[model samples]
Target: MGIRHSSAGKMIWLLALASLIHVSSLEAATAETVKQKPPRLNIVFIFVDDQGYYDLGCYGATEVETPRIDTLAQNGVRFTDYYAAAPICSPSRTGLLTGCYPRRTGNEVWVHRPDSGTGIPPSQTTLAELFKSEGYATACIGKWHLGFSEPYLPANQGFDHYFGILHNLDSYEVAHFEDQGGVPLLRNGEVVDRNVDPGKLIKLYTEEAIGWIEERVASRHETGSSEPFFLYLPHTMLHEPLGVSPKFDGSSNWGLYGDVIQELDFYTGRLVDALERLGIADETLVMYVSDNGRGPGRNQQQPIRGSKLTTFEGGLRVPCIAYGPGIREGHESTVVAHAMDWYPTLASLAGISIPKELVLDGRDLSALLLGETDTIPEFNQKVSLNAEVPLRREFHQDLEWERIFTRQEYLNAFFYHGSHGALAAVRSGKWKLALNPSLTLYDLEKDPGESHPLNSWEIKTKLRGMAIRFQREMIEQGNSN
Candidate 1:
């Protein structure tokens, strides 16, 4: 009996040892898998209106100070050759949000007047909506210049909460606009707060944005879920009729424009501080870009020859920076990226798939931001076309613009606008060609400031042919739509 009991004990010990070894192997495998997972990234997009490329310190501006925006570029990636989809405000915003070309939505024209047609078609899907569907809590603060009426507001789109002006604020003073005051201070679509001070607008928006961060964090903790949050904060201070808070009224030596830019910098610092305080700074992605180029028109020191209406480089080239957890730091990408690229970039970062049916002109720049690509891929670039195809029958009833544009004289007059129109540029690597209406070819790589026009007609003819082809492609896309 004692021998039988000894055999049974030996068998039990052997089985127990095998079980322990299997459990250890499983735990080790689980840990290895966990280590290989990609980190989640949260996004905080800061968009400023009418901010020039030289407005920020990182962009080579020594005259004015922009410490916070400068730090963002210093800590992450600065896009030196960034372009807006349009020289004006609304179309640019449309392109940024939709990830599609402005002309695709038939809104290349300006939308300054209150009674202007719908900015971006309501039928289009927005970036926020895509992110929200991916479990991100989205909010848009400061400026929503895409549309001006019913079914076009932020909440109507995909934003969970929105606080700021629906249209672009032309004047900085609160007293300038009468319809801005009183109730929900406009909640979900209803007027919420009556009588808001323009001087206090930035502060109010900041506090509200902070509240959103805190609320999302608390909600996530309570639900035991890990989800990212998106904050689209577009400031209106740096634009025309610049206004600064009382604290920064006399802070700069560069006049009102300088003061307003400084104030915007301060606001940026405040938002960064808020994110840090909430302990979500490292998890969040912050992208700062201007809505368009300078708005105060031309000056002796800063000659903005066309102001907001022109398509000059001064009107299209704007400051852009991206800082986040996964993006490389202290690098400058001369890749010619446009504002339209933001929507697709953000969607890609969140691991959300863009709808296949909806055509997106922009490319996902994840590889570019991660330092995986030394040169921009040809498949990921954009081509511009300067063509005039009249849409409304009434608008083209008087003359056939098609015949005129096909002729060489029309091209000459177009480039003679002196406002930067009648030109189409296609950039890949260091080679860039600007096809002007004068049948002139400009190599932007050697002459970035566009000081000298090229003397080669062959190259110009090739560029013209390319531009014409691009226009035809656009028309084909439009017809398909």
Candidate 2:
């Protein structure tokens, strides 16, 4: 009996010892996994000024050479149904930066001058502010048209580094430069170059951007940190008073405009190459988009129908591309995406949150970017304060500004306002109803160009009601603001 009990006790001891050894191994493995886990994503947003939807090779520009930009589409996702917040600059930038309808923020109707007192309100939080909250280095290296003044400047708007012009090159009081300060180029609130040359901006921006990135990386290494970065490279070229590098002068079949595009493509390639050289390419995500579509005559195919500042499809829809880590490669998503979406999408990726009181107009697109889902989910806007999903798709505040926009009209709808803030059109799914100029209902799925209008009264009436209600809500928001 004693011998049997001794054997049993020995067996139990061996089993417990084996269990403890397994547990210790697991704990060690867990620690290693946690230690070697990748850092948060580094984001580089490349926004160009006054680019056309069909201006890039990826978007079907045969006259201009955009091979480098096309490479992004070949390697990543290109958005066909992407629309800018507005058909113009200041309003578009406001929507993209604030993630709220421009009208909601009260800047959709005007562009900021060099000496303008009114700019992006200081109360509104920007994407830079959001990224900064999560310990990411933020820099704005290019045209910053939000506001040229103190509070509206990039520095006070949450950017750690700012190297760009406060307003557009054309905003200068004089048309020509006389070697004196015409348009100032600022670096961290100091005027580094007076009488800035428009032709040289692309190169300077690229260099400054890459240099800033390198400095940030070096700082991280010196401090033994793994912090990520957010770089907003809003290029200053391609707008009015267009200029290109002498090397790229007359390089394309299309004239100076094409040369400007080629230069843009070249500099964009440089930025991408820098990311790869830094070994952060695979861990970084890059977005290339335009602030708004080009003005009349850039693409007659576009302007003949509707150009920038108009409520037509050509004016509102623009090209967008998402590349690098966490984004599906070589895919063109037809989902309706917008400029404001980036605000929430980036925040979600960084595991951060925006202010609760702020009404967010963008939907979280991280799931789509990560290859988890294709369709953007829908939710009720009323429960926005604590909702798990996005309230709706989007509302075009500048397609045509109506006096009022009722928020509770439709969960999934888009409103179009004109440059002057008139509510001109409303869209639901594939059906688009144009109010101003004419009450024409066009099936966008079938007639993407708005070439043909269907006499479907039912569809038109439904969309009209949606628009009227949306306009009512806009009035409410406007008054409250």
Work out the TM-score per prediction.
0.79, 0.85
RMSD of each: 13.3, 11.5
After superposition, the stretches of candidate 1 with alpha carbons farther than 4 Å from their true spots are: 1-31, 34-39, 171-185, 295-307, 377-436
Winning model by TM-score: 2
For each candidate, what is the lDDT? 0.63, 0.74
What would the per-residue lDDT of candidate 1 be over residues 1-481, giving only the tens digit for each residue?
A: 0001123332332232222222333245554443433325578888888887677778766657888888888877899778787776777777788876677676666653455547667788888888888888889987677766666778878889888766545543333456645212454565656555456667777788888889988887898777788888877556555667889787887787787778778877888887777766656778889877774323344433334555556767788998766566678997777876777666655656566566766655655765556444323212101011111101211142343233222121111111222335644333345544454455556655555767765555544554554466567776766
Worst 10 residues of 1 by lDDT: 384-393
**Candidate 2 lDDT, 1-481, residue by residue in tens:** 0001123332332332222222333344544443544556788999998887888998878888887788888777899888888888788888898887787778877576655677778999888987898899999999888876678888888899999876787746334343565767889978898876789999999999999989978887899899999999998877888998899999999898899999999989888888767766756778899887774334434432477888788778888998765566688888877888888777755556555666777776666765646766434222121123344333544444333333333644666767786678887778889996678998887777787889986777778878766777778666666
Lowest summed-lDDT stretch of 10 residues in model 2? 1-10
| Residue 175 alpha-carbon offset, candidate 2, angstroms | 6.3
RMSD of 1: 13.3
Q: After superposition, how far is residue 161 of candidate 1 from its true place, in Å?
A: 1.1
